[model samples]
Target: MKLLETIMQRAQQDPQHIVLPEGNEERTLQAADAILAKKAAKITLIGKPSEIQALANQFQLKHIDQATILDPENYDKMEAYAQLLVELRKNKGMTLEQAQKLVKDPLYIGALMIKSGDADGEVAGARNTTGNVLRPALQIVKTKPGVSVVSGAVLLFTESPYGENGFVMMADLAVTPNPTAQELAEIAVMTGHTARTLGGFEPRIALLSFSTKGSAKHELVDKVVEATRIAKEMAPDMQIDGELQADAALVPSVGASKAPGSDVAGHANVLIMPDIQAGNIGYKLVQRLGNAQAIGPVLQGMGAPINDLSRGCSADDIIQMIAITVNQAISLKHNKDGILH
Candidate 1:
């Protein structure tokens, strides 16, 4: 709630323009109404205006028209956007006709808006797969400078004492599978930054493994150990340690005993999972069993702010994602000067 308030204040102090590609989806429309009501940011819905309006009236979603609605078929900038897309993809063997066809996709159009600064960010995936939501961004928005890999982090919150300060970040749950040492290091950096940005803490990062400080020796543990070294080398000022067992990462005494002289042992607020299986299963376990609130698969390391929603996400989820996206926009507009980077 405090985070939401902070987002609201930031959004009000400096509004961001957000584009939603799944404008025809009921949940998106519902969220648009609430986000507009909160003035969380200016939202533009990508949909056929007439059909969107008719559905809004039928569903009784208020303030539908408060957000701009654009249909790619009839948008005034379609051709210009097509030309731009062609220019962007010309080296990739794209043609004017191919660009024209791709521009018809709402996701591409929304991505174009971001590339052109027409919008500060884009959020979609309620009605589309993560791949569909991300492809256009990969093609147009690309990755931020110095970011080699992109990962997704879920910020989980709970009242359980196991959670550090009632907050924690679990990484690579929605993206990246079987990461190498370098990729794992990147995920750690991204998750650490995400924890600080959204959770309001100095990150104590734990690169998790089944072993604790070489208590066990295997290729898996070796990978974590190597990742820890790389992460420390890359982020010396960050309090990070790795090759930690899950309990050692969370329990202070266990961490002290298992990983003596380590800064992140037993004090980690961010967990960098080695692979998607662990990352996905770990977050779900905390969310479902520990009764923690799982807030994201917040896609990280993008050139501009963009996010993907679970198809089952609620309107409230969308609103929260919009808030997070706005914070990301703030980070970008102010010289990438946020805890996230």
Candidate 2:
């Protein structure tokens, strides 16, 4: 199957309710059209009704309903939410009108939708900075209980001509520039949970570093070692090990030589990097050079699994991220029951 087909399959199964911020943009409008045409789920678009309608007509796109467009101009409808928005932005020197303008912004609107259960998830950042996309989510939706840091992961998949599938998840690629050991552990645990939830397998995590065990000496290696220990303690039932090199973590023969009798060394599906620099570079290399289909830098460990899109992302990227977000949300709901569902 093509990459888009794989993404569509996941979206169809989950059909996550999604909100599109900045829906007035051409790309955002196109994405909303695609989602609606696919009968994927309910999609709320943030924009002025007339502006959105004009764009839809210009593009000859169907399913462009006025009700689906969330207009910030509807002050009466937005009164309570607008007030909350003002309170949140008061420190930024925003007056009531300015706060209202910001609230109408697609990022802020989408974040509010997620916070209020108006949407299951959101996809944004095509025309916004990473900070712009994440700020509202952090401020309003906040982090999950006991989760102090927000991190991200990419779902890397490789498929052969005959259709065999292989996947590896990498974390801290888009968030946490220089993570402490505890922060790294949080990333590890969060990434592991996401791998299982979205990728459909029990995650075996490898805390990747430049060395296997104590073979190399560096603060980075020490960080991975401590993170691995912390992750194990935090989720005792989780299968995780760390301080392994890339080759050891990914190659069976190399893993056997480097770390004897380890469960996660070669078979690990979730790889928690020592920091963002390595994780970001590693996943992109796999995607651009190794021909793997990279599905995210999907943000995790927030109050919910609200994901941000690459400004370069296609409509298909938004669809896949929504499906992944659905999986994360459902898994979180099930986990809160104190048993796997």
Candidate 3:
């Protein structure tokens, strides 16, 4: 089965509660209607119920009524959620009044819902900026235990014959402009995890660079080599190698020629680019020139699964992201329970 089909099936088997802060947006409501029809997840919309319903009617979205709409204006548990926020932010001198006022924002309330376990995951940014969407999540939900930074990965369905049946994952594509060696190591490990859980394949990760092995010496190449070592220490069982050029990472012949006897030099299914510039340029080049279907910038290392969408996303994009978030939530639960390593 296709990767997305498998993810959708898994979501159907064990649906999660996913909250959408942009409930009043037309495309989000449309996607919510579709998700309700598919039973992919239980959706909580953070907006006025009546207004959402009216917009649904305007769009002729039949299944929007099935979504649970919690109005930010008059949520029943406002005080409770506000208190939760105050507790979370009290160290930062956040007062109850400040928390109460902030909770009235749909984005803040949606994140608080996830933080309180009222929802399992969150999807937003249809009408909001990336910074605005992530602010509440970072403030409330925070990063996962032992994780310092949040990174984004894209699951590229390529037409190439390499990379686990033409499926590959690349990371640091949407966030983190110039990560240090430690942060790069974390990104590599987290991207590998995303590959296993969402891509349904064992990850052979390559920390990409301009140099393959010690063929060239530079501070940048040194950084990748250090990251590779740190990543191996982090996830010792994972297949990771690096300071490899793009060709050595993806091409079997080049990998063999460049880095002989290395486990991950040639057969890498997860490519961890050194920085956002390389990642952004690389993914786009493949997506446009190679005609690959790029699925994410799936946000990783959050305390809960909270994904940000491009403001220009379509309803179908939202639907796919919702399913992805559900699967991430499931994976996180399994990891916490030691069901998956």
**Best model per TM-score:** 3
Candidate 3: residue 258 lDDT (0-100) = 99
Give the per-residue lDDT of model 2 (tens digit) for 1-341.
35346446656666667777777878778777877777665687887888999999999988767237777666344656667777776787667887667665667777776776778777788788789888989977888877888888887886522111477778989989999998898888888777666666688889998889999899878888998999888888788999898888877788899999998877777888888899888888878888988888888878766788888878677766665666666666677311211
Instruction: Name model 3 segments beyond 4 Å from true.
Output: 336-341
Clashes of each: 0, 1, 0
User: After TM-score superposition, what is the CA distance of residue 46 in candidate 3 from its true location, in Å?
Assistant: 1.1
For every candidate structure, what is the RMSD over all alpha carbons to the true structure, in angstroms?
1.7, 3.4, 1.7
lDDT of 3 by residue, 131-207 (tens): 99889999999887778888999989988988888889999998789999998999999988888888777899999
Name the lDDT value of residue 333 in candidate 1: 74
Candidate 1 on 163-250: residue-level lDDT in tens? Answer: 5677788899997889999889877887776666666568899999998877888999899999889888777777888889999998
Per-model CA lDDT versus the true structure: 0.85, 0.76, 0.89
Q: Over all chains combined, what TM-score does candidate 3 have?
A: 0.97
Q: Give model 1's TM-score versus the native structure.
A: 0.96
Instruction: Give the TM-score of each candidate.
Output: 0.96, 0.89, 0.97
| Among all candidates shown, the one with the greatest lDDT | 3
- Model 3 collision count: 0
